[model samples]
Target: MNILTEILLQAERTPNAAAIVQFGRGSGCSFDEEILCSYRTLVEQAQGLCTRILRRVAADAQVGVVMGNSAEWVLADLALMLAGCTQVPVPLAFSAPQAGWLLQNCAVVLTDASGAMRLQEWLETGLDLPRNTMHVVFGHYQQQSAAAPTSRAALSGPDRIVKVVHTSGTTFRPKGVRIRRDGLDALVSALWQRASKDDYRRYLSLVPFSLLIEQVTAIYLPLTSGGALLLPPADMLPLGSPGVIAADRLEIIRAARASALTLTPALVEALAAQAIRLAGRADALHALFGRPTAPLLAAGGAPVANQTLTTLDQLGIPVYQGYGLSENSSVATWNHRGANRIGTVGQPLPHVEVRVADDGELCLRSTSLFAGYSNDDPSSCIVDDDGWLHTGDLATRDSEGFVTITGRKKTLIITANGRNVSPEWLESAYRSVPGVLHVIVYGDDRQFLGGIFVVADRSRADEIRLAIADYARRHLSEIEHIHTPLLIEHSPDVMAQLFTVTGRPRRDAIAPFLSLQKDPSVHEHP
Candidate 1:
C-alpha cells in the first residue's frame, strides 16, 4: 500500500475538512486553530515536496530527520514517505554524542532552523557529517508549489526498509530499528479498523515526532481516522530536558479542545488532577476537548496505574491503556473504547499475536515486528527462529485475553513518553559524586527522572545533593535530570528492602518514600 498516496486520497475526499491545525497560530482568536493546511493544501504541499525530494534522494536511501514538533516536521515526515526514502528520525532530547552516533550512519540529514544550528555545532567535535549533508527544512510549507506534483514514488517491495527507527534506550549509545513498509502498513491498518472516522476530530500530538509511535498516532492514525492533527505550540514541546511535562500543558488542553489524543500515564494523572479541580463544571469536557462527550484518550509508553485510569473514567475520560514497543511498530496490544481491561495493558491488537512463554515472558508474533537492529550485538537479539520476538518483560494472559505485564527480565526503565531509560547509565552519573554510595535511578511510567541515593557520609547529605544537582545541570541531558532525590545514611534494612534477591530495585518498596503530586523541573532542582 502507498501510505502517502492513500493519505492524499483521503485529503481529496475531504477537501473541505481540516487536514492539520496549529492552535493559537491562527489570525482570529487566541486558540483559533489556524488552518495550517486544509486537505487541498496537504495534497499540494506534500505531493509537490515529494516530487522535489524524489529527484534528489534515491529510494531506500537512509535519510535523517532532526526537528521539533511543527508543521514542517509534518511535511518532512509525509514527504519522505512519499519519496520512498528510509527516514531516520532524531529526537531533540538526544545529546550531541547521541545525535552524532545516528548521523554517522546517514548519508543525508534533514533539519529545521534550530536543528541546523545544533548539527553545525557538532563540526567542532569533528563527529558530525559534512556541511552539505545537512538540509535545513523549517519553512518548506510557507511556499506552496503550483508545479505538477508526483503522486507516489516507486516503492520496490514490502520487505524493503522504508524507515530506520532509532531509539536512545537501555544503552547510552544509539541504535536503529529497521521498519519495513509491510509491517508499517499492517500495523496502522489494524489500528485504523478499531477507530471511527470521527474519533479524532482533532488529535493533539503531545510527544516528540521522533517517537515512531507518535508518528503512527499523530500522523498516520489521524489520516486514516479522518481526524485533524493539532500540533502542539512550537515552543510548548513536552518531554524536553529539565521538564518532562510541558510547563503549561493543562492550559494548552483547556484551550485546544482536542477531540482525542494519546498521553503518558503522568500526563493522564496531571489532566485527571485538573479535571478534578474543574469537577461538575458544565463545560469541563468541552474545555479539555472540543466535544461535550467523552474524548477518546489512549495511554501507553509505561504502565498506567489502574487507580489513575479509574479516576479519568469516573470523570468521563475514557483512558484506554495499552502496551507497545518500537520493535512492534508502535502498538502490539491496545484497549480500544468498546473493550477495555483495567490493570492490564489491554488485549493484543488485531495485527499482533501474543503468548506467554514457558518462562512467563511475553512473546509476540506480528507482521509489524521490526526488521532488525542496525548495530546491536546478535547475542542481544530478541527474535527467535520461529519469528516470535521474546520481549524481556514477564507477563500472563487471562482467560479473556487481557495481558498484565508483571515484571521485566532486563534492567531497562521506559519513561512515560515511551523513551527507554537505562538506569545503569543514570546511576553511573550519580555514583560519580564522591559522597554518593548506592544510587537507584527509578522512573518507570513516571515522566521525569527521580532518584533515591545512599550517602557515604551522613553529614554530607546536603552537600552531596547540591553536587548531584550541579552534575545534573552541567553533565546530564535535560530529560535525564533527576526531579528530586532522597539522600539518606546507608542502612542494611533499607538496602535489603529496596532491591530484591536479584538486586533489582523493588519499585513498590520505594514508592512510599518518593514525593508525588509534584515533580519539580530542572530549574527547580537547584
Candidate 2:
C-alpha cells in the first residue's frame, strides 16, 4: 500500500543500491545491461519529475502514460503517485484507436521521447481526443538524478484516487479500475509478505508494467525487499505489445539470472516442455533459467494444465499458482513457497476473505478491493452491498482453503445434448501443439465446440491440424473436442489483443471470428 511512500522509505534505507536494471541499454555496463538507476537516483529522478508534473497537472487529475518498459516508465508512475495525479496507463499493445479510447478522459499525458513520437503519430491520425491535451516528457532529466532533493510534491491522500488501471473488456471501450491509496497499500504489503514469500530478489518483468499484477510483483514487491527490478530490452519485452516479436524469451530470462518471475499458462507450459526435454543434460535448468538453481516461477493469467505443473514438479522448478483480477488490485489468493497445491490457486491472502456462492461463483472481499470503476455508479459496480466482488469465475473451495477456479460462471459451453464444458482446459490442450500460439473455443448452447487457432507457422498448417487432432483425441472428452477448428495467421500483436491479461479471450473482440461457428456450411476440421 502507498507504493511511492514505501519505495521512498526503501530508498532511504538503501540509497546506493541498484533498484532498476535495463538490459541492452549499452551504457558501458555488461555490454548490454546497466544498473540504470540506484535507489537514490530513482527516488530523486521521480521527485524531479513530480515537480514537473504538478506544474501542468492539478492534484488528482487523471494523467495518461504511454511508454515501453524502461526506468523512465517506472519513474513516471512513481512521479504521478508522488504528485497525486490519477495515473492512467495505456498499454503499448493497444492500437492507436484503443489507446486513444483509454486516454480519452485524461487531459494531460506523460511520456518518454519514444512515447512522445508514438502519441504524436496517433494524434496526427486524428484520434478523438480530449481537447488541448498536454504532454510532458519524463526521463529527460536523467542528468539531474544525482542532484540533491528539491521541494517535494505531496503524497496522494489514502482515500484519494491515486491511480486508474484501464482494462479493455468485451467492448472496444476500456474500463478504468479506480484505485485508492489505502487499498493499494494493503494489497502490496500482503502480497510481498505472504504471496511472494520473500524469495524474490530479482524480479524479471516480462509483462507490461501497465498491468496491476506486474506493478505489484515487478515493482512494489522488489522495492519493498530492496531487491532489483530486471527489465527486458525492448526487443525482448514481448507480452503486451503485439508489434514486438519476442526474441528467445527463455534466453533473455536466463541471461537476467532472474530469481523470481511470473508467466502466463502458455509461457510456463512452453518452459516446462523445454525443461522436460533437456532433463538429461546437466545444464537442463541452466537452459531453462540461468544457473543450475531454479527460479521462483508463478503461473497465472490463465488456468495452467495439471500436466504442465506435473512436468515442472518433476523437473524441480519451484512454481506457485495463484489468481486475482484488477478488481482486487492484483493478487488476492496465492500459493506461497511452503503451501503450494498442484491444481489449486493457493489460499486467499491474509487480508482477503473468500466465499463461493450457491451457484459456484467464487467471490472475495478485501481492503485491496478497487474503490470502483472510474466514472461508473457505485451501485452499478461489480462489488455488491455486502462488499463481495462476485468474480464471475466459477470456483470451488477445498476444506483446507485451497481454491480451484473451474470456469466462468457465465461462460459454460452448454451443448444441445445438455453436457457442459469449460473451454479453458480444452483451449489449453489445443494450444499445446508447437505451432498453435493461442486458442479460444466457443460453442455455448450449441452441439459442439468451434475454435480459432493462432498458428506460429502457417506453412505447417497440415502438420499442426494433425497435431491438433492428435491432442484433441487424447486429452478431450468427445464433447470437448473442437468440431470446427479454424487456423488463421496474423501478427503476434493482432493475436495478443484478443486475450486479457489473465489469458482469457476477450469474446467481444473476437466476435467476428466466432461468428463463423454459426455458419452451417463450415464443417469440422478434418
Q: RMSD, each candidate, Å?
A: 3.9, 10.7
Candidate 2 C-alpha lDDT tens digits along 408-482 = 756545432223355655577677788998888775433345787888778887888788877655444344556
Backbone clashes in model 2, listed as residue pairs: 1-184, 1-185, 24-32, 242-493, 301-502
lDDT of each: 0.73, 0.71
What lDDT does model 2 reach?
0.71
Lowest lDDT block of 10, candidate 2: 239-248
How many clashes does the backbone of model 2 have? 5
* Candidate 2 vs. true structure, TM-score: 0.75
Per-candidate TM vs. native? 0.87, 0.75
Score residue 80 of candidate 1 by CA lDDT.
78
Which has the greatest TM-score? 1
Each model's backbone clash number? 4, 5
Q: Write the per-residue lDDT of candidate 1 for residues 485-522, one digit (tens) a residue.
A: 76767888767867666766676676665543243321
Error of 2 at 341 (Å): 0.5
